[model samples]
Target: MIWNENIECASRDSMSQLQTERLIRTVKRVYHDVPYYRKKMQEVGLVPEDIRTLDDLVKLPFTTKTDLRDNYPFGTFAVPMSEIVRIHASSGTTGRPTVVGYTRNDIAMWAENVTRSLCMAGVTKNDLVQVAYGYGLFTGGLGLHYGTENLGASVIPISGGNTQKQIQLLQDFGSTVICCTPSYVLHIAEVLEEMKIDASSLKLRVGIFGAEPWSENMRRDIEKKLKIKAIDIYGLSEVMGPGVSCECTHQAGMHINEDHFIPEIINPETLLPVEPGEVGELVFSTITKEGIPLLRYRTRDLTRLIYDKCECGRTLVRMEKCKGRSDDMLIIRGVNVFPSQIESVLLEMSETEPHYLIFVEREGNLDTVKVQVEVQEQFFSDEIKELQNLTKKIKYKLESTLGISVTVQLVEPKTIERSAGKAKRVIDNRKI
Candidate 1:
């Protein structure tokens, strides 16, 4: 069932050699054609030849989101505009969107990588995949669309939104595989319950979820609700869409396509490489991309890497599920909190649903956090004493886990807003 066995199962030494060769050519290409990279290399008094080995990757300057913003549009692209067959950009909530370009070869390579990822998830030509990620400027929908076709699987490019229609299609089409954000899949589960359709009525066997940091508890919830094997897939628009890495049937860690993209974990503050299996910021170098090759691009995602061979028989390095982004980490009352941590605690409890929101507010020069959680229909009783006990239990659990006292308010089912895309987990109103 392994796709592209030559690349995915290459020996460590063979892979390293392949990466070195690709890195050398990528560096030389960017050094000459891209002014941004050329200037970066010149400022460090380094040349393309200095990056002859994989270890020499440390010599190259790191590219950040700010660098992409300063460059704008196509400034970071190595090839001319005519050569770029496709363009994609981030949502750019902070400022100008980080733009990425792709040549024909880049597109082909992306399809190949995603095909490998689909195969890893146990998707085959006989499966029908329903792509629920957004299309157009966003990469998720189209990325999975072509990958499913490339894998010889029938694809339904349903895109996002239209919940009722999504459920109808899932039932009518007998989709065997689904690709979308984890949150949206949960939303689908809620809709399925509302429609009074048993999950076994359809033929869904596999769910590929990504585009957000979700917890293992959330995975279990998804599996229970949808009755499908939930697999995690990781990627970014800056590096490549949804195919950068994916979990196999083992579900241990996501196997990175190291033959095409080189991954490094570095301390966010010190900017030094961390020891293997240590939590740090994840960085990437696009060694095989042609239109816009990046050197040591800082991804800001916090995770650790595993180099041991996976039980799935793939030798590619694997990364633990991302805990959270460095920038997304919230500091409240001198304590660091990740929304995923809160999510894990909430999902572990049977009285509450996966839907919740974290609100941080400033009151009287002090920062306070209030968590709004959704209570299951059976748990939403009007008995005041019962409600009080449930709230106290949740508050105690959150305080024990987060080391900070938080107000827990239990709302009725479906009170929190549901997301059709990436879930909005945190709302910080503190004016700091």
Candidate 2:
């Protein structure tokens, strides 16, 4: 099947009509197949016929993470068990895992979306793609895996961990592209330096990093260290995994797969749509979804949208890299703090590494925020006085940058836990 061709180059009216038609069909499918969706539509006094066009979607109830969790394993599934080819779930740190099902066609659609993402990233059939994301229920690994193969490239499914082996594969296999989280890329760069390996000699030309928010400064740092261009990929398992949107070679922002997925931004509190260029929670509507079609699923990911045509010649709507999540935002002493902000400051500090944990706790009536940083190996000295001086410098710099008092604890190098999958960079103890 041909994936929507006009998606990246169509006029606005053309895209809207395509979305409306798909939305009508998806609404009818959900109303007939998914019991949960039927109940939801009934609760809102909305029948499938009530939704005539894309504009009418706002009148429908929005789906949330809680909705997916409430459904559990197969409650939201629209197809029969025999039709489902595979299942994936979220990390489930919150509660019951949010499950997703894919049919044979759904799998092919996933591959097509990922192939489009790679094309945006300038990947070609001749390139050797090295996938470093963790495989399993996590969508990052297999998402890129299918995409690389679909794009007709040689794929090395070197899913995360084993930094040394990852480097070796880059050298031996002549990998031209890599996909992993941004921090892991930095960690691999540090390992390469220790092994006296030259980054340019590895033959890696592009790096696609996501699964967490990162800054442009961090992107520049990764590019400098790995001697490659860095592109961002965005997705959630609930919204069909890592290839829902991707950065174009233009490097402005990520282009949403507007043909298959409708993107909207809304105020978290009011649930009213926000104007473009304004930051708000993102809501996704799966237009061509088969097993589980989501209608206006509240992502809680804070980002802005761009409607202008990209330099890469794709007309798909672009979304800015997420600034942070509403649920993950930390409030300490009446100040809103995001881990990404702290990470930016750490990257600017020459004496610090990317590994740091935020300790947020309540001391009596006041909330205290402490940033624990591991000293860089090259900067680590045997003298205790030197370490103390380093801690003082970090604390002073953080205070000046964040405009908030924070205690800085300097630990020995390689002390913080290195995550094989998603890096846990923040530990909030206030709830405890």
- Most accurate candidate by lDDT: 1
Lowest-lDDT window of 10 residues in candidate 2? 329-338
Candidate 2 lDDT over 87-197, as tens digits, reads: 987633232457999999888889989999988888898999999988887788999999889989999999987888999898888999999877678778888888999
lDDT of 1: 0.87
Residue 84, model 2: Cα distance from true site in angstroms:
0.5
TM value for model 2: 0.77
TM-score of 1: 0.78
Candidate 1, residues 199-299: lDDT per residue as tens digits? 98889999998876677887998899889999999898889889899999999999999998999999999999998889999999999999889889998
Q: In lDDT terms, how accurate is model 2?
A: 0.83
Q: Judge candidate 2 at residue 365 and give its lDDT.
A: 26
Model 2 clashing-pair count: 2
